[model samples]
Target chain A: MNWKPDKNKPICPQLCEHMSVLIASGEYNPHDKLPSVRDMAISAGVNPNTVQRAYETLEQQGLIYTMRGSGRFVAEDVSVSKQSVKTLRFEKTEEYFSQMEALGFSKDDTKNYVKEW
Target chain B: MSELLRCEKLTKCYGTKTALDEIDLCLESGKIIGLLGPNGSGKTTLIKLINGLLTPTSGSITVCSEKPGPKSRVNVAYLPDNSYLNNWMTVKKIVDYFKDFYEDFREDLAYEMFERLGITPETRLKSLSKGNKEKVCLILVMSRNAKLYVLDEPIAGVDPAARDYVISTIINNYNPDATVLISTHLISDIEQVLDEVVFINNGHIVLQKTVDQIREENGKSVDDLFREVFRW
Candidate 1:
């Protein structure tokens, strides 16, 4: 998918994209505490408000947790982490399979392609 | 006991520009304080100063009787207007981090939130769509058991459906004894839950009153008053 940055797009979208990559790549583990808002804003080169929006977005998704005084962190659940990764990969696989089918690739051909890989 | 938050002649400047002009305010616990203002009115600047994210040019701000610092931060849960998560961490990793850092964090609540939102821990922050990311952030902030919760713009950019969820989460999750200060230009959506509303114009607080008092005196909703006070 083409993920070009649009100036009109809010900062939350961009920040979320960065976070998604981190989570998918396993750079941050489950139940790991995140840095402060000020620190993240400075590092991301965005306004604190924008960073705050992203954190809120993340919270709504249940991917991270925030503590009153300490700061935001990754949720603590291995099963959740596995399930999230599985869902993501499954969705992508479904998309690819659907696209291949649309291009007239038969099931046999698809199976052969998978085997070749 | 002293007020939960006390700001006495607090001033903040950005070079030659004065963002907050000697503002004095007191916030008590168990109340939802709405910080309302127009664009460039320094509402955000004042919030930053109180949270210790920005130093005031003059005057002082006290949270629970101590100056705003690491000590004050422990009791304050701040939600800025943007995302603060590192793009590299997985949802599970973020949760693990919170458990380690916050002594009062409840793992069960976090899990319940995940179930409610259908968010899986294995998902990478980058994989989820824009709306889902914001939801993740909201769940995290609301899970904390803080004494003061500062939400800069809890519902700004998202579909209408998601806005309802965000607002509901905030109302349902907030601790009744904690102080919640929400700053936003979108007043109508949040006015119903706010116990008190404070209006700022040109970096100065123009009005501060209880929701009931405002309605009784002005015979208008907080949004209407905001429009009248901030009419350009």
Candidate 2:
């Protein structure tokens, strides 16, 4: 994924969301090791602390697990992660709809517009 | 979180001219912080005091619980606002000097950076251009694996490519337990990498907040907020 830290959006949440998507798509299969915090931070052009916060968020959701000092890895159970991916996709869709509505787009019109994707 | 550095009512005066007023600040470990303000806004004064170049007129400042002096200098890697290397010295000699003075200096990293910047070890400091001189200074400062890395306007007066190189070098280095205090007016260039920001104006701290908190509260970038806070 071509992801660079965007100053406009809060970096931690954006990274967390991106990692979740990758996990859900099986790009990072179950039991795969995630990039270390420092590696992710450098590649993303952000502070390691921000990356750490993002990793912690993923860990809390059970999408990733830590083996003490070894490193963080994708969770073994795929079903739980798939469910979270569904919820996250739904949340994003809702956000897009709400934004369209605020911009004067009707629900039916927004549905038709999304169909173009 | 452990307190890596702290200042209490820190005041610095230059022959009755108060450069830094009564300022109280604290920096915790494991974060990248920006010290930002306009020119003559006490940004450099604060950094200098922290580096123990200029002693405080009143109050006190400490690094790792030790007062700022030779003792604290051990843990602090400071980059001054100018080309401090002797013009007659070769770049290789300067690297050796850094290795001698700073126990944490990494020769391999210095060589790697110099290679990327096309800075030959035998090149004299006086022979290099202003931009190359700045790059050398940045390389020397970052080569040290110090606990407190204090950089002053590291990206200023340099080209965009050089700025990107310096910022990336800083972001990749430094241990998680270390704290980086960067003093610069170029907010937009460095905002994405900053975990926290301290805004100073006329020798006083106007604000200190995490980048995420500031964005959540103001719905704008730190650069916009800085302009708003310090607008004429």
Candidate 3:
């Protein structure tokens, strides 16, 4: 999938979100070792620090685990990550809903647009 | 990370024209910083002062706590905007030159990068294309395990196809402890690789922010903000 985020969004969080989405979609299976931070940064065309931040976020959210002297890996049971992805989806939807609401769309109007969508 | 570079009220003037105004900037190790500004906004002057190529008209700049000179030169690797090597020399000879002058020069790594870039050691500087010359310069600079690396307009003339190769070479080769200070006016092409960015205008620093902070607070890419900041 395309990896474009909002033009100016911080690359770290965007990467975190992207990884979580991938996990939610089962692209990265349980226990899969994610690419090293430096490698991901190179492929993603971003700073290694940014990739490190994304990995930290993933760890904090319990989506990934780190083995000392080894590397980061997907959690053995990503159900927690799956749950959090639901939360993230809700948050993003809420954000979009608010924007549409501010543009004078009612809830039913949005529902109709979603039906059409 | 320790402080790798520092400048306090650094200024440079040529005759009556001020190239750099009083600029106070500090950079710590392990960061990739962009010294961004439009043409003639003093990016080159600032880089020159740090590399000891030009003496500051006023104020001072330091690398690893010492003023830029023979001592600082040991800890700093500089990639100038223009080709500085003798055109008559082969790339291999220039590599030897760096090895002789810099104890930290990693000949093995230079040779490895040379092989990967398909740059033959036998190629003379005069025989190389403009882009190849720039690549050779970068490889030579990266061969050093210096505390600070100063690169001036490293990608200005590179075509889009070769820019990524250049950027990746920069990322892959640097010592983890070193700081890279790249000066350029083009933001979009290199913003992703930058940890922090220093914005300069008319010789004055307008802003110095992490690429993340700039995105979070302004909700705009550095390129967009640069357009707004320097817009006529």
Candidate 4:
């Protein structure tokens, strides 16, 4: 995947978000094996330590898990992926609403615009 | 055992000029640390002292818990800023030389990188372009499974494409048990791969923090912070 993590923000959170998006989108299926930390770091052009931190965050969130000696894998539960999708949708919708408010558009106007679209 | 390198009040001077002032630094293993600063800021002086090329005027510097002598030197692989190889030596001969000089050198790994770079072993150093020569040096250094890898400006003086190649080579060859110390002035290009950064100025360290800490505390990338810290 083409990873463009923001330079001004902490890299771990960004990596976590990107990987979560991948899982929610089914690009990384529920049982798919995740790339090794070194491989991920090389692909994203990031430090291995940062990638390790991101993986730990994902594991804690139940989006991924480690199997001893076999490396990390996406959680096998389909509900986990669905939950990620719901959370992502809410985050993006909230972000859109905030931006609209900043631009002087009311919440009702945003809902109307989305409904009309 | 985790402390790969440490400098206790290390000082270096040349005649009447002090190149490196009293400096104390500690580096742990499994890290890619950026030794960042402006030119003539004593980065090279500190690297030389660590490599045992120059004796410190005062204080002590240790690599792998031993002074910078033969014992420590064996475990440290240094890639200087400029070319230090003989021009007439072919890539093949250079590989042989490195294998003989460094016990930890991996000839197979070096040749593997050469094949990927499309560089032939028959090609002499003088015939290759500057960027390719630098790449060869990096390959040789990385091929060594040393405890500490000291790279001096590995990304500088190369085209953008070559810069990417250099960074990828570093990432691919990284040993989690060893610490890699890279000295560079171009912070933005190499910021993503650094676990921590050491900001040096006027022969003294001004800041030492993890990349995440810098971003979280300052709300800016290491590159932006470097600009602000070293701005005239």
Candidate 5:
């Protein structure tokens, strides 16, 4: 769950990455209230809007819930977390496999490479 | 219901060139409107006129039954294309200034927005990077509970990620009843949020329609229509 900021990455994406790491690390537990939007924005050195967007995205992903005039909290379950990770990993693996096949690598070569690594 | 903004034969002139020519625009409440135009096509001029920062050469603009003036300005929140803050001020000081100027200014909301952006009260406007500065400007403008919000080129210079965040911020913070007029050349990213789209070219409004109607009648997205209408 360790996450380091990549200087090349845009601020909001990096912020989202950092937040994800924090969530995966259990630093922000399920149903835990995150900091206020403004507070998070200042700490991240980004526009509040960017942080707001990230929060909205997380909510849409079912990783968070927002209560009007209250605050946003982590979702009560890890289903979203598992789904997101599985989906992301599958997509990446599919892409990588395609590239390996395109480069003339056989199934045996791929299996051998995986075994070796 | 009263209109949020009304412009009739609005003409704005520079020293020798006309920036806006006989433009007539009417905006209602509770909708996000896109003002699309190429550079130097008078989008900024039109916004400036509505914000009462620039006087029109020969025309009329009324916001909420009054002419564009100090009273109207009080009800409007404007974000210029460029940084308009005094470079010497700290973020905290700027918040104070806004509190003094805008009756609806919410200090707590500004502070919250600042926190979300990871900006501090101690942060000096001059010391901030360009992107952070823009964020601060946006936070200040959006913190206000104004009747009309005018944002000119809100996402022009920012990175794609930042642009998305800015759009999200607008969606999250804007008062549902307020009228938002956003002018930008990047139409696709914002077309989804707009209730209406107004296309301008050569200092004139070429088309205006509700986003739904545009989609229905033209069988095209607002972005597609924009590309076609403003095509070379």
Candidate 6:
């Protein structure tokens, strides 16, 4: 963790996005244990309350599940992680295509460049 | 989730100078709040009133639902802006002094931090570098398991490395059920760690809002909003 969060955006959402990317990319494998709120807070240099909020939202989203006495873990099923990856991929492609279009390159040109590379 | 501190029409005056106007505030446990303001603001006055170092000119202040006195002092750990450590005392002696004085003091935690910092217990406070001395003070304050931790400018006048150490020490040592109120004007350095921020100006509270709320509503970080709010 190199946690370089964007200061312009709210940190909780950024944390959620970061964790989601990690889970979807297999960096955090399915059923891997999530770090405790205090540990995550120290690593991220944010408040524990903020980390707790992110974890609660993550639990609600079904990306992570919490056991009564243990701790939070990534979902056991891989489909949820795969679905998130698909959404992220589409988002990244859309952003890149829009950027290329603004620079006077058509979507076809962008596709050709990728194919050429 | 209980209320840890409250101020009701709290006012403080020095001679004819009004240092703090009547201000009402409440703080709940388990929060890390930032008391942000420029110099000459009522931050110090409010902190003093909370600690019972100075009596309020009028109104009332409470900690754990009781007035600031012997009973409340036991639950509040205060790190004043100025250094209060006597230079003659060795680190070990000071540790003993604190452990004997405060019932909640944790000597083991204090020694652990000292060892991690490579500070020998036998070293005198006068021989330590300025940054190391500040760290010692902070470690002592944080070693106590108090309900409310009031730190006034804990990061001020230290090197960046020491600043990081201070911040991390705070995040690591604080009890999860307690609330911490840190007062500082250097917003950007500690903004990420703050749950809520209270902006005070000229002895009156200007605004109070959660850090995320500020970012989401104002479309800017708390540091940027602080600059905008306190800009001359």
Best by lDDT: 4
What DockQ results do all the predictions give, each relative to the true complex? 0.01, 0.59, 0.68, 0.82, 0.04, 0.78
Decoy 4 TM-score against native: 0.94
- Clash number for every model? 78, 0, 0, 0, 19, 0
lDDT (CA) per prediction: 0.76, 0.88, 0.87, 0.92, 0.80, 0.90
Candidate 1's residue-wise lDDT over A4-42, tens digit each? 333323345556766765665677788777766656654
* lDDT by residue for model 1 (B1-59), tens: 23788889989988999989999999987666889999899888988877888988999
**In model 4, what lDDT does residue B85 have?**
84
Order by TM-score, highest first: 4, 6, 3, 2, 5, 1
TM-score of chain A of each: 0.61, 0.76, 0.79, 0.81, 0.63, 0.85
- For model 3 chain A, the run of ten residues with the poorest summed lDDT: A1-10
Compare candidates 4 and 5 on DockQ and give the better one: 4
Q: What is candidate 5's fraction of native contacts?
A: 0.00
Task: For candidate 6, list the clashing residue pairs, or say none.
Answer: none
Candidate 5: tens digits of C-alpha lDDT, residues B140-231? 99899988999999998998888877876776664446878899999877765566789898899998886656766776777787888878
Best by DockQ: 4
| Structural similarity to truth (TM-score) of each candidate | 0.65, 0.90, 0.91, 0.94, 0.66, 0.93
- Give the best candidate by TM-score: 4
Q: Model 1: residues >4 Å from true position, as ranges? A: A1-117
Higher-DockQ candidate of 1 and 6:
6
Candidate 5: C-alpha lDDT: 0.80
Candidate 1 chain B: minimum summed lDDT over ten consecutive residues — where? B167-176
Deviation from native of the Cα of residue A79 in model 6, angstroms: 3.3
For model 3, what is the error of residue B162's alpha carbon versus the real structure, in angstroms, after optimal superposition? 1.2
Residues A1-117, candidate 3: write the lDDT tens digits: 357666688888888888988998899998898998778877888888888888998998888999998999999777776886898989989998998999999988998999998
Q: lDDT per residue, candidate 4, B40-150, as tens digits?
A: 899999999999999999998999999999999899999999998899999999999988989999999999999999998998899988889999999999999999999
Q: Model 6 TM-score? A: 0.93
Tell me how many residue pairs clash in candidate 4: 0
Candidate 3, residue B14: the lDDT equals 96
Enumerate residue pairs that collide in model 3: none
Stretches of candidate 4 off by over 4 Å are A78-85, A100-117
